[model samples]
Target: MKHTKVKDLLNSTKPVDDVLVKGWVRTFRNNQFIALNDGSIIHNIQCVVDFENTPADTLKRITTGAAVAIKGDLVESKGAGQKYEVQVKNLEILGDSDAEKFPMQPKKHSLEFLRENAHLRVRTNVFGAVMRVRSVLSFAIHQYFQEKGFVYVNTPIITGSDAEGAGEMFQVTSFPLNNAPLNEEGNIDYKQDFFGKETNLTVSGQLEAETFAMALGQVYTFGPTFRAENSNTSRHLAEFWMVEPEVAFNDLDANMDLAEDFIQYVIKYTLDKCEDDLKFLDQRLTDEEKQKPQAERSEMSLLNKLQFVLENNFKRVSYTEAIDILKNSKPNKNKKFNYIIEEWGADLQSEHERYLVEKHFKSPVILFDYPANIKAFYMRLNDDNKTVRAMDILFPGIGEIVGGSQREERLDVLQQKITELGIDEKELWWYLDTRRFGTAVHSGFGLGFERLVLFVTGMTNIRDVIPFPRTPQNAEF
Candidate 1:
């Protein structure tokens, strides 16, 4: 059956003779007013039912979560909440829902409870707004990259090499776990596997995308990546999406510019396109902030925090400079930091990064020239040889949103790094060839998609931003 979306119908300029809208029932108020939604938007369209004329059996089926088709006349809404609604002329129950058993009732549900019912949580206003904002943000990402003339490339999911060298990778195997083939050393013989070699789920697409950048000049990979870390923190997930863009002939300065501009553009795009959903989330956040202590509450509202990013220029500082600032910061000096910055080359924790962005700089900061020892082996080594041309864009609430560097284009320096890190050189033979052939100065960054969504939606937990979060011992739908 042909039906108009509730979103379009709600924004109608004038009345319509007959309109059909099929959606799930949100609520049946007094058996006279029906709140129906088809997932076109967060708000439900009100359908006023003529309960006096409708059959008792048909009216009883109009329960929450039930699927129904409403044929009605569209006109101005006398209701306070919505602008326009439907005057139901006919109502047909397409699918019946048991009122006693429907998990998503008309009452408010806690985030934890909603997580358990993840499949049905989208029926709620908050999740509906979040997922809708997520969809628009995804589209904005692609639109921004496409406008910049970047080639969208799909990288392999299974790989024989670890891009980050973190050693937290999920192994892929077809052999029996108990009786896998073994060599003389009694280790599992990878050659007997289905792929004829050991492989694991890819951690990052940066390594593969770099090869394409050499040929295409600018390329990006936006796809799922996996990690095997056992942490169950609100900030981590076993499986998540990554957006890695590699550009040839782009140095550290160009890379930083791209990251800032790209973030601002996509955020503005989402703000413009998903105004209704974002406004809903903004209010949701404001209410949530009310529950917190006065000292802990955010100074700016959600929308203001977003506008802050768009209006201000991200402050650029070297890693050494950040370390110096943190050394004298009140948190570090007063022993309030969990991981104190004692000296240079010290690894900065989330608290430290946040202090630099939220407190010290008082704006988004792009920290560059990080110590080479703390970064991956692929980043280029500076002439002083102590640090690399690396940078991380730090947001106010989010610590490190984007991590990237000017890749080491010199074959010898890269080889030395690979050897120093004890990584098997043969596994990255193809990646190495990118430098051997036509490599010039190149740079790129990897942004966690969930982190971006979390920042945009004002969601505290990383799990809440993604539809189905894969975490330690919890993979339930």
Candidate 2:
């Protein structure tokens, strides 16, 4: 028999048609109504099952969260709230779930408890919405780059260089830890390791992607990256996905434009394609009505601002300008800040980032040309010799979703920066060779896919945005 998705059944104009729908039961209301969803839509179709009319044998087989196939005739019902209903003719139990043991219930569950049940959280409405938005946002990323003549390049997960140059790396080896290569001092020798030298999971794919961009003109890498930083923040994870797009012959301004356009594309796509999911998230997770305190109004206001951002252009500002605005604010404001937003050279924390984009700017902000000392080594130095051509796109709530810069094309300057930054020049011969062979001006940015998903889905935690998130102290399936 042909199967009809539950969502299609609900959205159809003809309700009185024969339909077959299968899904795990969300809840059975009053033993008469069954709300079933196949993870196909934000809303579930309510299958009105009259237990009195349903065969006694079939009724006995049904349970909450159980996989069931129902052959039914859809009917238009003028119920109190529903637009359509299903009249069941036959019920087949595909699988039975013990209601008592299942993690989800009709009542609300805390996000923390749901985190512990990563495998089962998708069955919940909030998580299902997150996964759906995550999917559309990812598709939009590929769509934006492909339309702009950018070739999709897959970079290696294992690497010899740290693109972020942050020094957080995870080692890879075929040998067991107990019997690995030893040095003269009897320590585990990285020189004689499996890859014949020190190697670790790549922190970012920017450097390798830059090589491809120089050849292909424009290339983007979308893949997994690892960091062994042991950070346990709600935003940091051990393993996550990133999209790094590098373009040749681009400067800091071009880099900022690309970042802004790419973000606008994703936001517009998610708003257009995942309307139902976004509405669901906006209602349940980010609604002002759901906040517990009046002080939390700004948090909800940020959501409205994000929605408005889709229809508006982002604001561009230099680091110096942002600092001046912060310095000018009154010493005592109505809303005290969690972290101070200071002068140009200081790193912008999340609190400062949120305030700039969400409250002060009231729109998305692109802060460019960060101080060279605080940024990575590959960034091109401005003529002033103080600032680097680095750019960060700060979104409300998420803060710095994209970090990028124009690469130093001059071999001498790059080599000098490498040495000054304490990075080994010999280890990056292939990277430097891009300059030797015929280097062109290039720029790229790495957008943390999880953070993008959180921004798109209105999810408050990075853990909820990623499936089976690999955070510190948690690797369970």
Candidate 3:
């Protein structure tokens, strides 16, 4: 007989008389009862069997974590303490799982322990749930952009220039890491490397994606990106995924609309599909918070806040206003802040960002028109000359979930800014050529995919949600 999924069986009203089921054993009891889960649902169903009636060796062979096929009769089992139960008539061992050596067991394990066994960690309930949610989120991203007529652009993983303008980038080459290359100035010579000049793992695909958007009118790139920053924090990963969407003839407002809608769409999709997973995370969050001081509780109930943000409109504010709020804020009872957000000059820190969103705004807020000095050179210079048409979406717990801006489309302005910023114009020749051909106003943003996943899944550490996370000192799989 063909096997029926546990989920389908749960949903069906018809009596599950004489059914066939096959799955790995989650837990086994008294050599007769076993809990089976094939990841069809978050919760595993308990299967009851009569050990006296079955073959002794067959019962002995059926161990925990082993795959088994059961020819069973499913009855309305109320006394077995399960909503529905399967009583086995005959059992066949498909494969044996080494119960004593398998990394995952019924016992609760720490995240650190799970990280050590990253390859097999997906067997755990938390990881299994997260991977499913991650899968759905990827699909939701494609569906949202595709439905809006946005062309999906596959950007190169290896690039000549760093898109983030950050100096951290991993060198890629066929030669040894230390002895491969050298220049006359006693510097690591890229001339001997694969690209002949220099190339590194792409920090972001925004620039390349912009080229496609200019030609296609609207486009997006979703792929893995690498950064070699030595900082090893819970939030930073050496290798992570990024989503960048560019649109031609779109301004800051249009870009913000896309960001908000994209976020809401993903949140709604997860809630609709992974209700059980979200509930599990919610329980986990509650327990974690309970151990902390009562006053230090998270402001928004993670799950409730997600639903609220998905349904409500996001607030929009200018960088200047955010500064004013920060300045007016009562002097810190603790040490003075390193960078005081004075009227119009400094970059906003994570603490300042959280204050604005959690205290003043009480919701997700888009802080726009940041000071030109702090923003990227490609941002459009406003009439004031001090600020640029840039925006950063700041959420309560996580700061700067999205960063975007209206590109400096004017050739003269872009060229002058590039020169003034001491950037190599030759490196951006192809980009400048886009301006020479047909320059239309354009805007886009880079969403840190891991950060977004952290927000939606209520997972504290970014490493927890990602499979085989790569950090500074740890790349073990």
Alpha-carbon TM-score of each model against the true structure: 0.99, 0.95, 0.94
Global lDDT of model 2: 0.84
- The residue pairs found clashing in candidate 2 are none
Across residues 228-257, which tens digit of lDDT does each residue of candidate 3 receive? Answer: 988778889999999999999999999899
Query: lDDT of candidate 3 vs native?
Result: 0.84
Ranking by lDDT: 1, 3, 2
Output the number of the lDDT-best candidate: 1
Q: Tens digits of per-residue lDDT for model 1 on 1-477? A: 589999989888888879999999999999899999999988889999988999999999999999999998998889798888899999999999999999999997899898899999988988998899889889999999999999999999999999999999999999989899999999899888999999999999999999999999999999999999999899999999999999999999999999999999999999999898899899999999999999998887889889989999999999988988999989889999988889999988888888887787789999999999999999999998999999999987779999999999999999999999999999999999988898799999999999999999998899898898899999997
Counting only residues 3 or more apart in sequence or on different chains, how many pairs clash (N, Cα, C under 3 Å) in candidate 2? 0
RMSD of 3: 2.1
Q: Model 1: number of clashes?
A: 0
1 or 2, greater by lDDT: 1
* Residues 348-463 of candidate 2: C-alpha lDDT, one tens digit per residue: 77877777887788788888888999999899999999999888888877778888889999999999999998989988999999999988888988899998887777777788
Query: After superposing candidate 1, which stretches have Cα over 4 Å from the reference?
Result: none
